[model samples]
Target: MLEQKGNLFILSGPSGVGKGTVLDALLKDYNDICYSISTTTREPRKGEVDGEDYFFASEDEFKSLVKKDEFLEWAKVHNNYYGTPKKYVDKTLEAGQDVILEIDIQGAKQVRDKFDGGIFIFLAPPSLKELESRINKRGTETKDAIATRLENANKELEEKKNYDYLVVNDQVEDAIKKIEAIIIAERCRL
Candidate 1:
């Protein structure tokens, strides 16, 4: 068998764009893929266990990791620092597993700058209005946060050209198939 080339899949989209839902479905069905667990400075949410939802860290610990160059990509959003742990990804890829990093566009860009051949997939909403509505419908974000996300969505959409694949997620199953196709095509390229 040919040696499997490690694929670092950077999946990014605006908040409330169903990135999490698509990722959860993909994880449920894709055995060869592993989700990247990011380290965060934010406190764990209710029912979210440490090392599962995230590797929760103190602000000092996160800063220490930053200084030690331990992250593949790190960023600050709304005063919280979130970053991908480099060692886990390296080990997983070395073991020939496909690693998926469901990160933001900014973090994705940082990964792109560092890793030469990883695949980038951008999930886009069918329309800006629809995207905003989805964000609003989630009811997790405050009105101000929703507005901020809508504003950010416009900028994020402009980054489609930077990605290797752009999939509009108007339909969940269709989007999954598209993502599955991309993964298959990438595997063939190896």
Candidate 2:
């Protein structure tokens, strides 16, 4: 039997759609799947670790990486640059370990264009009203920032058809179960 090549799973959605929260729960149960850590220019939130949560870089440093073409895909969203390193992802996938990229909608589109095979899953909120409520409860964004996110979310939801799966994040546990099922089914595919 030939050794199976690793699969790429892209989980993306609009901001404030609970993508981060759902990912936190989903990743805790997996030891084999490699969660791709992205590099970004955004400041770390309260308890986010530098290397674990994200490789936080300065604007100049991020620009240098872009110029070097080190990133598989990178995008400027909400005034911060977020990118995935091509080297790390290539190495992990070649080793036969699955990779899950928890990226935003824009980055996912870029990655989809550059890569041939990947399971694109879009995490969605139950409704726009609920999404706004969740963002407000986070207390992380300013009023203006929240507005911008809401505006962007409206547009992103329109792109859901492009994804292979849409997991609605109305309840965290339920959403996690759905994603887990997707992973299990994908792994068993002949």
Best by lDDT: 2
Clashes of 2: 0
Can you write out model 2's per-residue Cα lDDT over 44-156, one digit (the tens) per residue?
A: 99999998889999999999999998887998888999899888788888888889998888889988887778999999999999999999999998999999999999999
Q: How well does candidate 1 score on lDDT at residue 114?
A: 72
If scored against the real structure, what TM-score would every candidate get? 0.88, 0.84
Report lDDT per candidate: 0.88, 0.90
**Best model per TM-score:** 1
- TM for candidate 2 is 0.84
Q: Estimate the lDDT of model 1.
A: 0.88
Candidate 1 at 81: error in angstroms?
2.5
Q: Write the per-residue lDDT of candidate 1 for residues 1-190, one digit (tens) a residue.
A: 8667578888987767899899999888877788988999998889998878899999999999999989989999899999999987888898888899888888888888877788999999999999988877778888898888888899889999989999999999888899988988898883
